[model samples]
Target: MPERQAFRERIRLEAAERFAAGAADAEVAKDLRVSVRSVRRRRRAWHDAGTEGLRSAGPTSRPKLSEALFTVLEQELAKAPVPHEHDAVGDRADAARARFQSPGPGPPGDRARRGGRGGLGD
Candidate 1:
């Protein structure tokens, strides 16, 4: 991913340089192996923010749910029935109803129930 980002940044820099040299968007797109739309977008960014705009913005960080909220969600999910219990039914309606019923305990090999991190298990 980092390598891909670096390559993308290089392309953006090259596009910006070509644009600064008064190259057409189509030419820059073809030369950089990118879409003309990308070239136009890079040109707009360059015009709006100079060389800094040509640099990668880096990955965006998303906020995770708070532990309290996560716990609530886990509790809600825990109320759902186990998938294995419905497997033998062979009936679609029964299977659907079973899927919505509480599953009770975790299945074998469930890391969360085995005291591993990140699940409804305490």
Candidate 2:
């Protein structure tokens, strides 16, 4: 979990004190720049648990994965060799560009073939 803002911590403390001093939740909320709902919640927590309830809960610890690892993996994959029958990188890229530039499939005027769909035959 992330830490709460310093302003929020201060607001919670001041709001709790104002509540204990007989200020209405709405008035405390307005003065503290927080919602009335938050004021009421803080009031209840202060009444039940005192100032400890108003202290920041602090942040939780959790490990995060590194993004550089992903970029390294992608670069490794892109540099891997293709089969002998396939074109080299430049030729393969040109072939892909030509295929993409061709008309696409649809109805009679579509760029797609309508018969004998031949993928890996599976």
Candidate 3:
């Protein structure tokens, strides 16, 4: 993955350099074995934010949980084997489900049916 990213960055850098040297998009695309549209996009990004703009954006997702909560959850998950590891999968799954059930309010799907905010109900 790192090698692929490095190759992509190298391509962007070379494309930017060629475009700055007044190379046509079609020519740069052919030389780099990439599409002319990609070359043009890279050129626009370079013009807008220099080399930094050509760098990978990395992952777009942010964690759904807070860092502290995520850390606790990770630790908890690490302590237990997955349900499928048991000889009796169905029983193990049921036991695991019961162990993690929400103790708040009414029975399982009741709140969901009542138009409550979250959960698999919706």
**Top candidate, metric lDDT:** 3
lDDT tens digits, residue span 1-122, model 1? 58988999988888878888999999888888989998888899999998898898887764398779999999989897757654455678787898899977566668655677645564
Q: C-alpha displacement of 50 in model 2, angstroms? A: 0.6
Q: Name every residue pair that clashes in candidate 1.
A: none
Model 1, 10: alpha-carbon shift in Å?
A: 0.5
Score every model by TM-score: 0.49, 0.46, 0.47
lDDT of 2 at 97: 94
Best TM-score goes to which candidate? 1
User: Per-prediction RMSD in angstroms?
Assistant: 18.9, 12.2, 15.0
Candidate 1 Cα outliers beyond 4 Å, as residue runs: 61-122
lDDT of 3 by residue, 42-111 (tens): 9999999998899888646765899899999999988967565546888888999999998877777876
What value does the lDDT take at residue 7 in candidate 2? 70
| Comparing 1 and 2 on TM-score, the stronger one | 1
